[model samples]
Target: MFSGAQISLYPMADDFVSVIMAALTGLDPWREALRIETDDISTLLVGPPEVLFAAMRDLFVRAAQTGVHCVLSAAVSRGCPGEPDDPICMAQGGFARDLALPDRIAAARANVGLAAVTGQDVAAQFSLYPLGEGPHMDEIYGCIDFLKASGTFDRSKNFCTRLRGDAGPVFATLCEAFTNFGTVAGHVVLDVTVSANSPSAR
Candidate 1:
């Protein structure tokens, strides 16, 4: 019965964000929450299925309003700030970043946008460093390091990271893994990926 959706409200109206949050707050008792950066803005919400859904509906209504330019989409996401991670459960969040196109992500998962991404098992294919601790850091440098270190390291210890689970379980484990990445015991960006069956991803 658990479900969620992602949306984009064009015109960059700040009130849309507030209104959406307000609708969600009316949905369920939030256990955890974070800001999910979308193509337009970002917010991460985690909570009960009923509440999450109510909020999603409200968001769609408001977004599709006469003046509010809106584009809405739903999918099988695992978790977020709106809901806290249930240690006793198996559902988890899948890690994703440097999103070229989240809407197209589903297509990529369907093996459509592979050429654009130019990589696979991307997390494993890259290296990471602290934000400003060395001659090599930053987003571009991190991407370079990631390409350079392909097939060398299992995980990097620069920025904090959250472990992604199988596609099926990725939705529920976000709170347990990604949402609280800031609380990780280390001060480095953690390189993480989902544990799934696939090729060497070279």
Candidate 2:
């Protein structure tokens, strides 16, 4: 599968540079796992869905911990049928990617020590889209079912869910959804917008 994300971070503070630096520095550990390129506008991360989302979780959480009111905008896509994957994406196939998800989540949990003024909760909205010629709606429902059953869902919110404690497990669930949908139904894409320490903060 060909997966990539174009992400831009907005740190709401006077010293935005430091906040951004902290977040980018956090990603250094995942550099070996992902292919990252940062330009003026946004950073492009290309790799498997699991690694890409996991890295995003780690990077965004670290940035938000600066207490600078950070908002991350990411357009993530995967499982493009005929699209040619970058070298980094192709290079990820040798190892067992499934086993790595749990390890990544554990690593993320150990790193998060920042206390939030409101509380340490992560919320996200996801729209899973299944492509290609098949029963896409069924696959989409299956993924959503998995998400809801995981006990992390806030069904009251429209197109959104909240993870009250560790962001790692929430991300792990998302990665599972992406992996399952794509592997079973073929081409799939997930449109996600995640926020940590959101403005509402209730």
Candidate 3:
């Protein structure tokens, strides 16, 4: 499967440049191991699941270390049907960004509260926008159904769902939602914001 992710790192601080740099720096160590492209909108990463998640762990943790409110918004997919296979996704053998802790655990650990995040649950807000296909609302509802089955939904917010759980499974489900909607449809764009640790939260 060819998997790719588009991510935007927003550090909630007046001096956010340093925070963004720190997060981008985290990916530097793994530059050779992965294919990363950055534009005005988001950074695109194409790689295997292990490498992709490992890189995300380092990137987000570095941003979180700044101690400011940081949110990571990602739209990830595993090769939409009818799209040409990206050769880079098939390439293998890449070193992890950090060696001290395992990839999954490292990312999960970073996604906790201000002082030592226990319970291992991070709150995420998702608004999936289904586009370029038949009945946009239908696709949206389909995603909503899957999200409701997997997490919690805020009734007042249309097309918006909030999920709290381990970073691994939550992210896995989010990725699946993209694939589910993108399979036969034209294209679906996902708006996702995940806060590992919110300084304002009590």
- Candidate of highest lDDT: 2
- For all candidates, the clash counts are 34, 0, 0
What is the lDDT ranking, best to worst?
Answer: 2, 3, 1
Candidate 2, 118-151: lDDT as tens digits: 2335666666676778767665565555565554
Off by more than 4 A, model 1: 1-7, 11-40, 79-84, 87-202
Q: Where does the lowest 10-residue lDDT sum fall in candidate 1?
A: 118-127
lDDT of 1 by residue, 1-202 (tens): 1223343333235575564554344324333432233444534333433233334434434333333333333332433334455432232333233233232233223321121221111121111222233333344343433322322224434553322222222222221122222211222232222222223422
> Over all chains combined, what TM-score does candidate 3 have?
0.60
lDDT of 3 by residue, 18-130 (tens): 88986788787777767889999989988754456556656877777666777898886554554566666663533222232233223322332212222344567776665
Looking at model 3, residue 100 earns an lDDT score of 22
Q: Which pairs clash inside model 3?
A: none
Write down the lDDT of every candidate, Cα atoms only: 0.31, 0.64, 0.61
Would you estimate the TM-scores of all the predictions? Answer: 0.26, 0.76, 0.60
The candidate 2 region of ten consecutive residues with least summed lDDT is 110-119
State each model's C-alpha RMSD to the native: 14.9, 6.1, 9.0
Best by TM-score: 2
